[model samples]
Target chain A: MSAFKEFSKGIYAENPVFKQALGLCPTLAVSNSVENGLGMGLAATFVLVCSNVIISLIRKSVPPKIRIPIYIVVIATFVTMIDLSMAGFFPALHKSLGIFVPLIVVNCIILGRAEAYAGKNNAGLSFLDGLGMGIGFTLALMLLGVIRELLGNGSLFGLPMLGAHFEPVLIMILPPGAFLTIGFVLGFFNWLENRRQNN
Target chain B: MKDILKLSSILMLITTIAATALAAVYSVTKPRIELKKQEALNAAKSVALPGADLNAIYDVKGNDKVLYYSGYMDTTKSNLVGYAFLTSGRGYSSDIESIVGVDSTGNIIGIQVLSQTETPGLGTRIEEIRYGESLTWVQKQFIGKSAKNLAVDKDGGEIQSITGATISSRAVTNSIVAGYEDLLKQLKETN
Candidate 1:
């Protein structure tokens, strides 16, 4: 029945990257750069919102037996659109995101939302749910990107922030760095969530 | 029985419609995708080896552990600039690929990373920063250095290894050494 709270839950309670852990592949891959993470997050948001709204409108007609395959077909269609548009315009981000763009078809966040919320909720709520989750996903990705870029490259968005005194941690830019940073951030988020619950 | 048959037919109809729509989208985007790939290749070549006036390029087959690209450069003024070689060597986490511009006398002119999948902070020094905060080291080490002493100074060579990424540093040096030798051999037999 509530609207604003539905949106807010996505940021903290149901954070796709850290809490729900949906779409882990791109969250890990594109988090290498703030630009990459932000780009991927926005593109994913487009797909999630569009698919959720449409699915919610047609939920009753889509028979339960064939709903899973139908949801995939819908998601894959939107992903292909993002792929073509990115390749045409933003070739650099397209290259960075690479195969992960197409792989969005299988991202649990979109499919899970479609099956759960979109299938039951009204179209308005479904749209809000998608938007909220998307912004949450984007925020988490940017947070990771900023940390990784600052520590690894000793820069934020390719501009030197710390100057000569900073010793860039070599491992922060590697694959291991992604894992370690995400793990630490996840732990921190969990700690914050627990503390919030206690309060 | 008639009702069940009608329901099955309806399912088939939905599947067909969805398939048709998906196929239409693919057909529309396929050519654009191909053109984008070609443009990206040209851009990468231009940045890696400046002003090559690149002709056709090829990925050399059956080589040992290196991704190689050797191609001819067609000059504008009725002259040739010899072959350009893009070869790979070992780096911190993966093999480092370098694009080399060479003249007829086998002297190295300029080199840059065509692409690298190295460790972000540590091994990325191969693209070492020359002046600014850019990755300048990797490209600069090739300056004035010959294919003769491509190995790092530790291995009785001239080039210095990156401070923390010695293995990655040496990996790149070894790749360059071997890559030059291989490319040189190819250039000689063909020319």
Candidate 2:
């Protein structure tokens, strides 16, 4: 596969949230606002790319029996680093994200990428893969965020867009809204994929 | 047996490296993080007791822990404005923590939710500021409310609970009330 193919696949065909269904916890929890969704996406992407590169570099030396533990340690170190830096630098975003920042350590997307792609591919390819996946994840969250924030709050990125007359759909920003939005988006994507395959 | 030792040793080495890296990051970020936390607390205090001198505020310790803060109108520390305290209560999901300021008469002056892990949309609306408003609706409701009238409307009190978030609203109200009562008892004992 070309370098571009390796990177582009994660954005559409194998999106972590929509297609693979990985890391939905943060996706659902923080996708209510564009700012939060973007922050979470970038934070997770940083961890994912960093961990993927390190994991790829160390893959040759890692014994299969102990690779999982090693991968977790690497992934955890990056997660904690991001968590602390975010708390120190962006306290407001840190407060908004709350526990989800630390919970990124448990996000299966990073681990899955480490185990499946990084462990097999070279560091260069792994970097591209991680970047693609992170962007894909970030985009998915932002899409959901845009939908939720617009409908639920009648605003986009904290700015009022729909005006006073638009009665905000109360459920769109709630927990059920996360599920409903993701369900429809997932269905739409699946339909798109089926059409592409049929053609 | 040899393979087990090798695997364990490798895992141990990886963890050690990870720990060391984390320690370095923690040290670098610790001061800034502490500063940010202090800054947040100071900001919340100012909001809770508007015009209270941040520098002049002093902690009232009980059981070797800070129970509340006594804010003064100025750095002279002569004129007492009110008391600001941190309190938390179990909400629908996580603890809803807030800083509440009450005047000398024990009527709340202002309040700010310091931290909460409530549901994102419904429960989290406790911090929501409606269009064109500065203070959140929940914070605005608490101003001038005394401990006696702190209960949410659902509980037959003056405070109106956020729609679809009665549990979280009640949690903040109840916790503030409890903390306020505790502060009064402590102040009386000290006097």
- The C-alpha lDDT values of all candidates are 0.75, 0.90
Best by TM-score: 2
Can you tell me which runs of candidate 2 are displaced by over 4 Å?
Answer: none
Candidate 1's iRMSD: 3.2
Model 1: runs farther than 4 Å from truth?
A: A1-5, A197-199, B1-32, B43-77, B89-97, B128-135, B164-171
lDDT of 2 by residue, A89-192 (tens): 99888988988999999999999999999999999999999999999999999999999999998888888888879887889987899999999999999999
Query: Against the true structure, what is model 2's DockQ?
Result: 0.62
CAPRI verdict (incorrect, acceptable, medium, high) for model 1 = acceptable
Shift of residue A154 alpha carbon in model 1, Å? 1.7
Candidate 1 per-residue lDDT over residues B75-156, each given as its tens digit: 3335544345667776555567766765556666666765565655567667757336444786667755676567787887
